[model samples]
Target chain A: MSEPFRFHTRLNLVELLGRRAGTVRELLTGIREVPGASIYHHTHRFLQQHHFLSPEPPNDFAYWISGSLGLNDIGERLASIDTVRYRRINDLRTRYVEILEEALAARRNSWPVCQESDEFHFMSCRTFIIPLPAVARDAGEFLDILGRISVNSLYYHVFESRLWLERGENDFAVWFEARGDHELAGALARLDPYTITLEGLRQEIIGLVRRHVQDR
Target chain B: MSRIDDYVPVAGASEVEELRLLAARLEGKTIRNVNSTAVGGGVAEILTRMLPLLKELGVDARWDVIKGNERFFAVTKNMHNALHGMDVPVTGDDLDFFVDVNRRNAAEMDLASDILFIHDPQPIALVERKGDLGGKWIWRCHIDFTDPRPEIWAFLKGYIERYDGAVFSAPAFSRPLSVRQVLISPSIDPLSDKNRDLGEDEIDRVCAGYGIDRGRPIVTQISRFDYLKDPVGVIKAYRMVKEHMDCQLVLAGGGATDDPEGLRVLDEVKREAEGDPDVLVLFLPPASDIEINALQRASSVVLQKSLKEGFGLTVAEALWKAKPVIASAVGGIPLQIAHKYSGILTRTVEGAAFWIKQLLQEPEYARKLGVNGREHIRANYLITRHIRDYLLLFLSLYFEKDVIRL
Candidate 1:
């Protein structure tokens, strides 16, 4: 028999890299140079931290650009990037670098610099993944455990696993597809996690699994 | 003190259950927290509430207060100011005595816990025993370390680099260090008397007892009497606001046992007040949590106005009460406030006065800000989140790699 799906949760240890950027050129340089973990942090911090209230929280770069540097045009463009579309952090990094380069190309002479204290601080997180006691052997068991596990666990399986770890699809979808449940797996792989709160995402997954079990 | 389950209603059942899951990873590991004082200060206040909940969750958590004499405290106070980037002098003798006190404490205390969590500079030197004691040492720095004095930083850096990890409250407060650094912001206990919801009659009673008229708008700032808090500057801003409208100012907080300059700063604040009946500069005791809660709940606008700060838990406390806050854009205050969205961020006394007047005149706008501020605190800055991060940090010490599965 195939192995059971062991649910896992994560706690992030955020570390400051001691690098900051006040001007657009410096930001682009830091983006290109800092570790991929740092880029992942600035993008996914809001999603993990604001798991309850926010449905569509902007990444730190978008917030800092528009809110601190008052660059609304580029900030909007950065915010509109569909993070769910990319499965690898390096690909995501390439998209952000392209956006910053486009902003600079448009305005060659006038470069915006934020206040001295308002520079963007580069940070990265070392994640500690801990497996939970909850395990799922079938779609029914998966639905039950998914409803009870912490939203943090849901975030890890859905967002961090699929994107930052370069997994083509989330662990849930992979597990089901491995069990010959292609329809459920495809449905889960299509869900946009960035557009909903973690709780809403949990409920949506539960609904899909419950329906799949009934259909089977 | 409230239990872990008591936080269920405020932090939600899922968040509370998550703490138990995280604490499970740290089961059987003894985590002992060491700080300078057992009473007064933010570190003590947090440990007082946090240690019990950790015990309830089956973690062998203990708190120990390091011993220091008057000379030792005075030297540490100078170190504290210097670390906040003040032009305070640190003598050669001062560094000698600081290490001497830590050495004495380290000898007497049990430094053999699985995890020894050192809080702030006062007990930082105890990391010297890590090689002998053979435990993971985490140095928790809860100060504004953005621009620390070179001599004091170099002195502390020797001990700091020996630790397994260092924890800073804000990214701005962190330094480039060989020891792995983590950013865990300080939090507010939402169920504590100091932040708990108060009845209308109780809030009115406390304000009236403090000689504050409940009829007029009240602007309050609750912090220890320290120069870094800028109590005198708070009065200047209050006076500027008073020139525009008829209102009252309540500046209330107590002194910490470790801070020797509190009374002197209180005197400076009283002199600045100059017996203005509208300016109520009351020196509260350590047990004035309910009174502090009532004062914050009754205030029309709250101010934090610190020249330098260490996360400014008061900003989170005020924000938890859904009071529109105008805090200085320093240290971790910026992390708590969203600059005119959740609360207004100010840079000067005049700017604070300007926002105080603007918020007072626009009552509806102020209410919206308070509502949004409380939600931000709920999502980010609560004791539940703090405990989760600490447990994760403790678990991380064992797992040397980036991602470890159970």
Candidate 2:
């Protein structure tokens, strides 16, 4: 755990996702069960900082993923796609998963094949949908996983909608900065997730995890 | 007696006459109460209101505030928490500082009354003058002592053993002391500005003054800005209710001069309530009793959501107003709230939220609780009833060996 990532970082993440993941452990555990919140968060941060975010004209999503986050093989498969042909967000998600299946094929040759229940997808009950697990050969699995999954049982049980109800806005941020978590403070100040739809969260989370993989 | 007729209206002619007759037994005895602050807090508030009435009943009642600087106040504040079983340490220097101020007060102030009432730990050391003054010293401990740390209790009991008797707000607070221990709960002066009945206009005006939408169901908690009061938890409970209904919450409180943690808790409460438009966090000034009264009267439900309390007067205040109260069952709260009878008693944030929603949802049940609550306070916890108890306690102090039953 990075000491620099303070409570403000969690607060910011909650804002970005539009709901709490429940307890700190629940949030951490939910992230762990998927791709990992820190990996996703850092990836998201790295991408936005590098101007690889969505809605930019002529932005090559394939170029952003290739060799960016430690997924060289996944990046190679993704880069083969005609980036110019992608029009809608769904087109990107569809094309993205097709490449992951190819990457999964390659990984199965090297590693023991995962059991019959390899069917994994997006699950959002609270603020966070589980990130694509590290075991996945492709980060693009996030798009498919985000497209389908049950309510996170752990997160649901620990669903803490009212944890920060005792503190003021920026109180956690100020405390983080005081504890020398300026990075966390800055990250927190940018998130405004109160009314964000699940669709909006998916894109936001996918970008983060993809960035995280690239940075790794 | 200093014009005994003043109370005849509230207590009725017979009750008032009986109280005066009880006071007649202790006639000519000068009762002096010494405490930390002259204003703010329940002890000071109760003393300010009760002393005059005691004097009116022919027991010469006087009030004196023991003086201390900020450092002294901070030390004593820690002592207060320690007494209530919080592991707030009081060092040797802190104890020395506490005694230094008490020694100065002991030398300067008049401890020459017939009955010396030392309220709480602030002036407990004044009992050091027991040998010099030889007056009957009573330590009135207005704190929750159900589970004090052994060292802290040992420290206080050293001085307590030298006193004639000890007075606690609840039976649970009474430890096995060598000195006689009496249970004397705090009381509400119905006519006091903070507890008096207010017109609907006044209630509405105060609500408007705070920018609260009075039409929405308002849940209010009136206490000092202390961590013990758990204003943060109150806001959380309010948020839980907001998830289901569009109700409003008002966390109104003031700080005592002697209390050092008030502002920090208030800031935390404000921060917790930052984005919520319906949660109103008010840091009321001293003597905002009428405003407090008006707020309580207007609130749909009142809460004394304390994590720890020493016979919470806020619960009693709300009950006296005939408002259905939701309070934690810690300390003397259960003594006042009959758990679904007079009012609902809850233990956690979810429970408090549930009760608040329940009361708001069922107005008839809420009203019934309120009506029953006011009667309960009237019969058991009013100022007049309190004075009679004190008079009886004072009379008991005169007897050396005999157990005087009221």
- Specify the highest-DockQ model's number: 1
DockQ, candidate no. 1: 0.54
Q: Best-fitting candidate, measured by lDDT?
A: 1
Q: Compared with the true structure, what per-residue lDDT tens digits does model 2 show for residues B172-219?
A: 565556776665678887777877778889988998899988878999
| Deviation of model 2 at B329, angstroms | 0.3
| Model 1 docking grade | medium
Error of 2 at B105 (Å): 4.3
RMSD of each: 3.3, 27.2
Off by over 4 Å in 1: A1-6, A54-57, A105-113, A135-148, A172-187, A203-216, B211-217, B225-227, B230-249, B255-281, B349-354, B357-365
lDDT of 2 at B404: 27
Q: Residues B108-191, candidate 1, lDDT per residue (tens digit)?
A: 997789999999999998988888889889999887888888988999998899999889899887677887889899899898
List runs of model 2 lying over 4 Å from the truth.
Answer: A1-216, B1-6, B65-74, B86-89, B93-97, B100-110, B256-264, B400-406
Quote each prediction's TM-score. Answer: 0.89, 0.60
The 10-residue segment of model 1 chain B with minimum total lDDT is B397-406
